[model samples]
Target chain A: MSTDTPANSESALSPEEVAELRSRVDELETELSTLRTEMDDDSKKMVIIATKGTLDMAYPPLILASTAAAFGYDVTVFHTFWGLEILHEENSKDLKLSSVGNPNLPVPNAIAALPGMDRMTTRMMRGKIEDNDVASVEELVRTSLDSGVDLQACQMTIDLLGYDEDDFYEGVTTGVGAASAFQEMVDADIQLLV
Target chain B: MSTETTETLDVKGQNCPMPVIKTKGAFDELADGETLEVVATDAGSVSDIAGWADSTDGAELLDQTEASEDGETVYKHYIRKAE
Candidate 1:
C-alpha cells in the first residue's frame, strides 16, 4: 500500500518509511479486533447459507443449522434472494416441491412444468417425504429456532422482493444486510453454503 | 425416554438433516454437562454427527456406533453437553 518503497532498486527502506510501516502494522492489529467485534462472538460458531429458494433446497440448510446448534455451536442461517422465501408465512406452510428443471426430478423438465403437474408432483413429493417420516419444513423451522439457530432474512432481498416485516414468519429476523451477515459467517468456525 | 438417559431422540427412518435436527432440539434443553443419546437410521449420521460435535465447543461427543439390524443400518451417537 506504500508507493514510497525504496524507489532506487539497491536502496533499503528509509527510516521514515520504516517508521510508517511499523505504524501501519499497529493500525492493522487495531483494525483486526474491531472487525472481529462485528458480530456475536460465540466460541463455537456455525453459519448455514440458504441461497436457493426451491422447496427441497430449503430443508438442508435449516436442518443442518438446527443440528449444528444441538451440537452446541451457535448457529445462524443467512438467507438471500429466493432463499428468503423460506420464512414467508403462507409459502412456508405448504412449501411446494418442484421437479421442473431439476435432474433429480423423475419426470422430464418440460412435462414437470406443465399445468397441474406442480400439484401432482407436490403431492407425490409430500407423500414420499411423509411416508419416509422426514421432518416437515414447518417442524424444522420451529426446531431450528428452538435449537438456537438464528434465522436471518436479507434486507436487500426483502426490499427487492417487496416484502415487509409482516410477510416473514414469527421470530424471523428481517433486517440483516449482507455485509453484516457475511462478516458473521467469516467469524464463524464452520460455515456451510447450501 | 428413560430418566437416566437425560434425553432420548429417536430419528428412525429419517434422513441426514432430520437426525441432526432432532438431536439439536433435544440437546438444547439439556443443562450444561448433561448427556444425550440419539438413535438414527440415516447412514449419513455417522459422519454428520461427528462433524457437528467436533465443530461445536460445549458438546462433547462421547462416541458414535453403527449397527445393522433387520437389513437396515442404524447410527447411534452419545454426546455430553458442555458445562
Candidate 2:
C-alpha cells in the first residue's frame, strides 16, 4: 500500500464542516434505525412438512408451528400422507401410539406385537403427557390455529385416503397441493420435515 | 422504568411452548410500552422467554430473575410491549 499524507493531515476541519459531518452522521443513524425496525416488522417465515400420523409423531410439527407463531413468525404446517390424520376431524383425537417397529419402545418386539398393545402404549403415553403438563395434540392444533399459524392439508393425500374436503378440523386450509406447499417452503426462513 | 401498567402472568407447572405461548397471548393484550411480569416453573423457560423476546419485534425482555419457592426453582421475566 502506498502511504500518502493528505494536505489536511495537519489542519483541523472548520466548525461549519464539522457541523455538516455531524448532521450527516445523524441522518445516517436515523436511516439505519428505521431500516432495522422495518426489517424486524417484516417478520420471518417458517414452514414445516408434517408427514407422520402417529400420536408420538404428531406433536413435533404442531408444537413447533405454534411456538414459532408465538415468536412472531409467519408459520405454516403442510400436512401430507399419513400426516393428514392429524387434521382429520375424527381420527386426530384417536391417533394411536404404536410400539411395533419403534426401537424407542421399552418393551421387546415380541411383547410389543401382542394384541391390544397399541392401545395400552397410547394410554400410557397419554398419562405421561398429562403428568408432565404437556398440551395434547388437539390442544396444540387449536392453539396453532388461534395464533394464526397456517395449517394446510394436502389435496392429493385427501383424495388418496378417500377423505372429503371437510374431513379436517375447521380453519384448516384444505386442497393444498405439493406445488403450493413448495411455494411456501421456498420462501420460508426456516423449514423442517417431521 | 416507566410507570406504564404492568401485568402479571403465572405459567407455573407448565412446560415448553405453554409458557411462551401464554406470554405471547398476554403481550397481545398489553398496550404499547406496558410491562409484563412472567412467573414460570419450567426450567426451559429461562432461555425460551429470552429467545422469544429477542426474536419478537413487538416484545422486549428487560430482566430475568431466579428464586426458590416451595422448594421449587422459579423463573421470572420482565418484558415490555414494543409496538
Candidate 3:
C-alpha cells in the first residue's frame, strides 16, 4: 500500500499526484487478483487412517476415499499395522471375517471358535454382499485406485511385520512414515480413523 | 427456470459410491452450464447425490424426483455444471 494521500480540499490537483493515485489503484487491483487466484487454487482434501485389516473393516475407508475422490476431493488413506494387508497383492482378496467375539455374528463364541468357522463366516458374508449387489473388497480397492485415491502404507509397520514392499499392489505409496501421513492429515479438510 | 438437460446417465442397480462415481465421470464430459440427468435405483442416492452436489464445485443440483418403473422404485436427479 502507498502512503500517499489525496487532498480533501476543493482545489485542483497536480497531474503527478493524480498519476501516483492511479498507479496505486492499479497495484491494489493486481494484489486483489493474485489473492483471488490463490484462493481458487486451493482444493478440498480428505485423509483416512486405516488401522483395521478385517474383511468388513476394509470397506469403510476404501468406500469413503473413492466417494470423496468422486466428489472432486483430494483423498488419501494411510494403512498402518494390520491395515497394511489391504494393500498386499494376495492378502487383499484372502481377507477373512472373524466371527469370534463379534456380537453381530449370531453364532455363539464357542461355535465360532470351531475349526473352519472363520472360513464359513467369511463365505457367508461374501454371499450377503453378493446378494445385496454391493461391491466386493476387490472391486472397491480397484475403484479407489482408478479414481486416483492415494493408498499409502506405513513403512514402520511393514518393517515390523517383516513384509516385502514388492508384495503390494501397483500405484500404492509404500514406505510412508507416520510423519508424512500426519502432514497430509493436517492439511485435509476431513480426517477419519477406521 | 428454462434450463434443459444436456446429457443423461443411467446407474440403475448400482450401490453406494458407484452412482456418485459414475455421475462424476459423466459430469466431467459435460460442458460448462450444461445439465445432466441421472437415473438410479439405489435409494441411498437421494441423499448421496444431494451431498455430493453440495460439496462439489461447479455442480448445481436442480432437483430430484422419485418414480416407480416395472414394480421397482427409481430415483432421478438433475444437476447442472455451473462453472
lDDT string for model 2 (A39-78, tens) is 7776689999999999989999988999999988899999
The TM-score of the first chain in every model comes to: 0.76, 0.78, 0.79
iRMS (Å) per candidate: 2.6, 0.9, 0.9
Instruction: Record all residue pairs in model 3 with backbone atoms less than 3 Å apart, i.e. clashing.
Output: none
lDDT tens per residue, model 1, A63-148: 77877666677889988888887888767877777767778778998888789887888898889888877788887888787766
lDDT for each residue of candidate 3 in A71-170, tens digit (9 for 90 to 100)? 8889999999999989888899888999998989989999999999999999999888888778877788888999999999999999998999998888
Docking quality band of candidate 2, CAPRI definitions = medium
Lowest lDDT 10-residue stretch of candidate 2 chain A: A1-10
Off by over 4 Å in 3: A1-41, B1-3
C-alpha local distance difference test of each model: 0.80, 0.91, 0.91
Please report, as a residue range, the 10-residue window in candidate 3 chain A with the lowest summed lDDT: A1-10
Off by over 4 Å in 1: A1-42, B1-15, B24-83
Question: Distance from true position, residue B57, model 1, in Å?
Answer: 5.4
True contacts kept of each: 0.74, 0.85, 0.78
TM-score of chain A of 3: 0.79
On a 0 to 100 scale, what is the lDDT of residue A38 in model 2? Answer: 72
